[model samples]
Target: MAVEYHGFRVTVDAKADATDTQWLCRAVLEGVEAQSETAKLPCIELAIPKLKIDVLMALSMVEQTAKQAIDEWWHARQPEMA
Candidate 1:
């Protein structure tokens, strides 16, 4: 799962071992920065190290955050649709 804001992308995934109930989340943000005279675009990747958490917690966090992001993105376009 992922969310994109202002041309930047944030991705989330969960991983677990069958022997253990613990899980972790991996995430990345892809976008550009101000570095040179011109512009730099993404797939310029910035990744987060694995976060130790439960699978359900990881999934819930990702889902809630994505929904909030989507809501904000949708509201931002309301004026343009009018």
Candidate 2:
């Protein structure tokens, strides 16, 4: 699944681990504006720590975690006020 948030493209995926006991989720974030640029920022990948047995729940957790990561990444790049 994919969605656009704050000028970024967030893509999320989930799969059953090798043990098939839980669902593993990950998210990839890329700059939408930099898609055509050669010097684009490297895509950021986030592995959600929360595991779930249900696919839908896993996806939900991944999405929330990814958005939080995006927010933090954006804030870190901003200049601090004096």
Candidate 3:
């Protein structure tokens, strides 16, 4: 699943682990221009450290984690106030 957040695109990939006992998730973030909707930077991949037995719960965690990652990324690029 993919969603737009903070002028960027976040794509989430979730699947069961090798033993099929737990779910693992990762998110790919790409910079996108608002006007043209084109990529502006290389993709950033983040591994979400959340394990769950249910797929729905895992997906929710991944989405929330991705959003927080995007927020931190955006804040790091901004100039700090004196």
Candidate 4:
């Protein structure tokens, strides 16, 4: 994914691998070297659930995208499955 705002251009690469269990996936995100930002972010779990919900939602979206892509590829080769 690539995004440009103001004068800065950011590009990211993400990879997800399914675990032995189908419901969970391992995800990793890497930013282009030139655009990478390394910083310590705050986490306050006691006050709100926003952080956890946002993370899970993003992961769910990624999983959905992967599932759609794989289904398309599989169905194209086997029309009967459609």
Candidate 5:
């Protein structure tokens, strides 16, 4: 449902509707592709698999954040224009 990042690049994404943590993680990766330069930037960390995954994978996605998810991703990839 959303992407969170540091290191001047996006890192994590959170989702609730996904069937599992891994699925949500993939969705985040896909979202980054659709919404950011993630597709172009091969070095983005979105592909790293989580080792200590949380059992509470289902998250209450913030409607506000979800709505802005695309914009947030775009910003991360193009902060200068944002």
Candidate 6:
């Protein structure tokens, strides 16, 4: 699952096909950092990690936060359309 927050899109690879954990972690870190940077939320990368448990928690938090942020952002832009 994935979620976009503040502009950052958080995604998970629950069953990565990487041959090694190191490679998987490296890919995940780079992917998240890239997403964060492209979203103009540089510091958001600091919230992501390679650890499984940490990733799960962060994913959940980001999902919830993203929902709220999107609701607020869009609501402010088009209150009548909401």
Highest TM-score scorer: 2
Of models 2 and 5, which has the larger TM-score?
2
Give the per-residue lDDT of model 6 (tens digit) for 1-82: 7544444454534332344232121112112344245432111222443444455565555455545554564467568978
User: lDDT tens digits, residues 1-82, model 4?
Assistant: 4443222232323332243222232323322334233311121111113334444454455444444443454467468979
Per-candidate TM-scores read: 0.39, 0.69, 0.68, 0.37, 0.24, 0.36
Q: Which stretches of model 1 miss by more than 4 angstroms?
A: 32-56, 60-82
Q: What's the best-to-worst order under TM-score?
A: 2, 3, 1, 4, 6, 5
TM-score of 4: 0.37
Candidate 2 lDDT tens digits, 35-63: 32232334443343334246777787778
In order, what lDDT does every prediction score? 0.49, 0.65, 0.65, 0.36, 0.38, 0.41
lDDT of 1 by residue, 1-82 (tens): 7765545456767776464454554554454323211322222211223355556666656645554553454456465653
- Runs in model 3 with CA error above 4 Å? 34-53, 79-82
Candidate 6: what lDDT?
Answer: 0.41
Give me the displacement of residue 14 in model 4, in angstroms. Answer: 7.4
Kindly provide the TM-score of model 2 when superposed on the true structure, using C-alpha atoms.
Answer: 0.69
Clashes of each: 0, 0, 0, 0, 0, 0
Question: What value does the lDDT take at residue 78 in candidate 3?
Answer: 62
| Model 2 misplaced regions, further than 4 Å | 34-53, 79-82
lDDT of 1 at 14: 70
The C-alpha local distance difference test score for the whole of candidate 2 amounts to 0.65
Question: After TM-score superposition, what is the CA distance of residue 11 in candidate 5 from its true location, in Å?
Answer: 22
Better of 3 and 5 by TM-score: 3
Candidate 4: the clashing residue pairs are none
